[model samples]
Target chain A: MSTPTETDAFEVDDSSIERMRFYGRLFLGACIVATLVGIVALIALVFDVVVEAWGWLTWEFLTHPPSYLAEHYDPSNYGDLPTGPGGIYPAIVGSIYLIAMTAVFTLVLGVGAAIYLEEYARDTKLTSFIEANIANLAGVPSIVYGLLGLALFVRAMGAGSSLLAGALTLTLLILPIVIVQTQEALRAVPDSMRQASYGTGATKWQTIRNVVLPEAIPGIMTGIILSLSRAIGETAPIIMVGAATSMFAPPNLTDPTGSFAAMPMQIFEWAKAPEDDFQHIAAAGIIVLLTVLLLMNAVAIYIRNKYDR
Target chain B: MTANGPQTVTTSESDGATSDDAMTDDAPLGSPRVDDAVIESRDLDVYYGDDQALHGINMDIPERKVTALIGPSGCGKSTFLRSINRMNDLIDIARVEGDLYFHGKNVYDEDVDPVALRRKIGMVFQKPNPFPKSIFDNVAYGLRVQGKDDGDVEEKVRTALERAALLDEVEDQLDSSGLDLSGGQQQRLCIARAIAPDPEVILMDEPASALDPVATSKIEDLVEELAEEYTVVIVTHNMQQAARISDKTAVFLTGGHLVEFDDTNKIFENPESDRVEDYITGKFG
Candidate 1:
């Protein structure tokens, strides 16, 4: 038998190897370009908003309520802050109230629903139908949910154009998203953990409370916070639920029926004003909204880092 | 022991009700019973949906001894082990039939709560699955679940860790996460967790198969030591490991059949069935 040469035993086609390398580089280049497109657009938008907001954005702008004569408003009469049109203070307060209420409702209802579906409910046709509907609801138009809130909460339920109606509306808009994301979080928990808990003779509830939920909490919190950030920036739903564009006082948290003004609605009003100064004020409002969003995302990331094992 | 029918007949003649009551009241560990058998299965069958996994498995697992079930993959050795503790009930499609009796009481009876049954019969799995908690919490979990960890939990946890032969390595860092430990240490931690409840029986399904040779030997030694107090029912794919540790060995072949069960020395040296001898010689699985 003839022995093969070493080169013949281990041969490489240089041209083919070079061609493969070229294709890999081309794919990597395309991916980089795709990523850069999103980053560049976001930077450009933020830069423009900050430049426009530079003169209008002030400490007083954050502390005073909206006014029709905001362009000529003076800061010397700080005692008359409620009547002053120097800032979007009431709108900021309204946004905080709205999100706080939304957070409590979503955490209770969304997390509860997710736990039931993931842990207790069997894979029956009815459950599948509900799961499918939730997925579809997440993709439904925000304006449609606005219409839902208008008809269900604002009119039929007698909540009127109040903070209660607006909060409930925002909750309805983001509830499906929260539920879907929370279920994903729960599903990400390893099945082996459940088995380990059960092997120790833990009942279903004990397993969930002690092992499953604690492990899934980080993911769940991240999902809920992200969904709330989206809800905070929502304009169309609050509009349909009748949030005021401008208000003299902050929202009355004690009374659900009191009128409120959210940042997005306030910005929308300013952006639509005849004077270009109000347009800059709208840009300032956008800056504040973006800051709040960034802060919320930071909290989400911190929670994920702290609890992830 | 060679004939299965006579053993079942004689065991059934005894009054089951009184024995069951006595078994429940007695402490699971170090109990002296009239009968030597801790678990007995009569014509036990298991199925996953339409496909059967175990067929008419009959065996009497002796008390306070290591009983090893040896079989190839898909031969239902693990299935039989899970059936002993009713762990297979977790699978939605899996079903059990006939009788699996623990201390003379049929575990499948309507009145039998699987949660309570599992407290008496703890299990370890093919992989070391320590919870993402501190070592102390992981060991204390079984007791805490049963609301039995009132004050002596720390002492019980320490004793369990010592029994599993992991205390020396992990004692200084008892508050550290169990996941931070090595694979062998994690498996030992899992063994500690299972035995923390002071169960009468410990079911292990390929417990050391995932570990290295050193870890495997450690687990083997630990299993032998555990058998002195707890009845260790182990399922292993390694033939030599079964021969080295088990008091009695049950050979399960393909198609979920229990071909032969006898003393470990007899099964390895002079088995009756031709297939059993062929399997022992590594001719076929």
Candidate 2:
């Protein structure tokens, strides 16, 4: 009923301080050790990749196309391939086409699904069922997606060995990731932002388009970048959809069936060959792939930092 | 703390039976009720799922006046305030019962478009949430989205910023990102963005609760000034703030019931209910 007197206020406690210090040391030491291990592993991985691939990189190597039968460098001795260095010209083009188409399709379907789930879907049995399936799909192996692409696009749809099949499969592979990231981005926007828009008499869609999406742009971009990088590095699914090893040129969208090889499948094929020359060539291809991946990842990091405020 | 619930204690002393007797005696020459109040509610109730959050409530919010809604946490003061603008419709499980009128038109009417309604009534949130854009862009967002290109958007942005009392601090840095400002400046920037649409009313939910004393006072002063041009409704937990800045105050209690509504002076000095008296007197919330 009464305030504490001076005598009561002066009572001190010392026993708990030592225990708190002990816990603090334990937690801090664990964090420091974990961070150090992660840094060391990343550095070692980069060193290994650079050392193995350094010899395969050269101006001619990047600009030239692959030759058959491990013969002499003379063009007259080989199967008269395209003018460029066994340059991954076709693979590079295919990768870009594959990634762009995948991104567009995924963005529409993934973001749409996220908005529907977040704004309209109540926590009903149907919504819960869909959510559980999405989380599980994110965990499904990339190779499985490749097989699905092979069956659905290559066989049933009869779009075998084409960029279209590759893109459609990649879209399926990344759809769950895009949806999850978009949902997280949408959720991070403060409820107050939505309230402010609604208070202004903004309609649900208007509020989302005007206020909610603007605030969520940085997050959405981050998700897009991450998903795109993943799509670029993917090799199994494209091979499943039949990216061939011998295609010397890029294919148009409407052209019928044709085998198209990507950088990863080429690298994998060359790496497994018996000849040392092919091994070095595959290592160079790996180097180029790594460079593209690095650039894409850097872009992702830049976007996240640019709008992180 | 005082053993009596704060609202009950405050209201008991402020109005109690004496003021009611006094009010009843004035029935023959009763106070004139303004028919054109900006927001009118009758038997308004709100529920979150099966839980009833707000009980029946009736009140008329006069136009161009600073009306303050005060209550303890979870008392549904914000809920009632949000209902005026139909902001509760955004919440998935939130359901409202009863009629809410804005300019004599029921906002819940099937024909009413909430988006159009929102364009006419802007809002500032408790914490400053400026779009991650330049100061000019943040201010021009509302107008630009509404297809308003009446002239130079820059000039209009400047006017809105000036009205929010933020221009002097930010005019030189219109291109700078809104996040670069200090907390108070950012809050004002949000206010500028809210007013850019020339909204008829502005709803502010605890706009000053997150600021320091100086920033809080600045916001209070801004609210007083804004009342001259727009119907300003603010919800605050700070009783002193309500007493200081608002012309009218509505006191709310537990479970979202409005206990009393009157002139600020009357609510603080002579409230009509024991619950309101207890609340303002620093007893239990």
Candidate 3:
């Protein structure tokens, strides 16, 4: 008279659950292995770079002028300046100017594009096309961006072969990356937050500025750091944009017309020399570059944790 | 209104196909009079994309009182409530037709700004959602955005928290992150946020659905008190909450139909519609 389940007083079986235990452990082990692989490689690379550059990392090496001849620039044999006065002061100054200039324009353009794509843009063909192009642009080679900088910033805009030209090219190369990341950061904000803001009667702009932007600050900052880091170390793009390999006097940082020498350009030039000392100086320059990059990422991580908590 | 049968919208007919019949129109059932009403909906219909979620909703929400909308899941109870504050406008595909009158102004009027309307009618969601900020800043956010600049933010926040009955608990930790508070405390903090703007109406979407029994009772008690000062329209799946806190109760059924609405006692004691009786008696969802 009773149903099958009721008559049997249905006992729940635990036999089938045993496989989940095995599978879960397997997945966990797989994830750990993947993480260890990345960590080990990163540790090894950092250790190698620090070891090669640590001995050459002196105070004078950091603050001295380049030893290359400006008029008779020879790569194979150095005449008066074989080892070169080898401080990267001018390169450091030039790189800082490029970073600052790139940031000023890229942030304004990138964040705006992201907000439009995420918030305002309708799902039409044009928007989708633009979004697709942005994704593609992020994957475009850095050298092509350098060429773009030459044709547009150097020729069309008359910026010439200066820090402005290099900075502008680098900005073009990283714009797509910034837009994509900023959009992701904006998207990560829960719709509930926007609803809560609107429920309080805030306007669209008001909600974005007050609620959306504050919550997305961590993600936005991470994107900015990542893009700037890429822009700061680039060699081919800067070289194509007419960045000089060596300049004895510090380049006019503010003037867009003056010639420039970035750390990568200087390092590339020195490392090309036959003398071993030039290689040491180049490695030291690399150490400085890595330190600058690490500091930027540290600042980003600190800001993210402060707000994320 | 049919006593047992629940009317549903059919795809064959266009808009204006459903009956405008009112079941609770019997003396003092809907309201004492229209003068006491703050918000009124006439033949309100809501559509999400091509699908209709609410049909022919006509009701007068009394001023300074809590009116609860109760029904089974996806019965358009929340949809109807969101329509009142024009919160549905936030959805890209949601469309609301018919007039939603708020104190004689059509909320959907071309000239009416949705932003301005929202400030007057605040909402607290089913889940407690506070900004990632200090308790004081969370409450002060709406005021600051309104450009109050009056330096009386601390005083206003205290008054609001006191009204929401969370002042004593959170007063000492005003500087602490709202996220750090317990779930119940965060829900209360959201209520305080809604009240800080001095809204004339408050819409609560199952405001205590995520809370424990004690917290649920606390929110129920807060709703009863809030009805004295603001027109509170709430959507809750819990009938007991509707009976306990609401001055009036509207029963939504399948096909986005409002089967019955009346004074809280009549709807519970002797529903005009048989479906309302069945729903109240747990006959069927």
Choose the strongest candidate by DockQ: 1
Q: Which is superior by DockQ, 1 or 2?
A: 1
Clashing pairs in 1: A67-A85
DockQ of 1: 0.73
lDDT of 1 at B191: 98
lDDT of 3: 0.83
Write down the lDDT that model 2 would get.
Answer: 0.77
In model 3, the number of clashes is 3
Best by TM-score: 1
Per-model TM-score versus the true fold: 0.91, 0.83, 0.88
Tens-digit lDDT track for model 1 on A1-309? 156678666455667889999999999999999999999999999999999888778788898878887554344455565555478899999999999999998899999999999898988899999999999999989989999999999999999998889888888888998899889989988898999989989999999999999989999999999999999999999999889987878999999898999999999998998887787888989999999999999999999999975
* Per-residue lDDT of candidate 3, residues B193-257 (tens digit): 99898999999999999999999999999999999899999999999999999988888888787
Q: Candidate 2, A223: how far from true, in Å?
A: 3.2
Which portions of model 1 show Cα errors greater than 4 Å?
A: A1-13, A73-85, B1-35
Q: After superposition, how far is residue A297 of candidate 3 from its true place, in Å?
A: 2.0
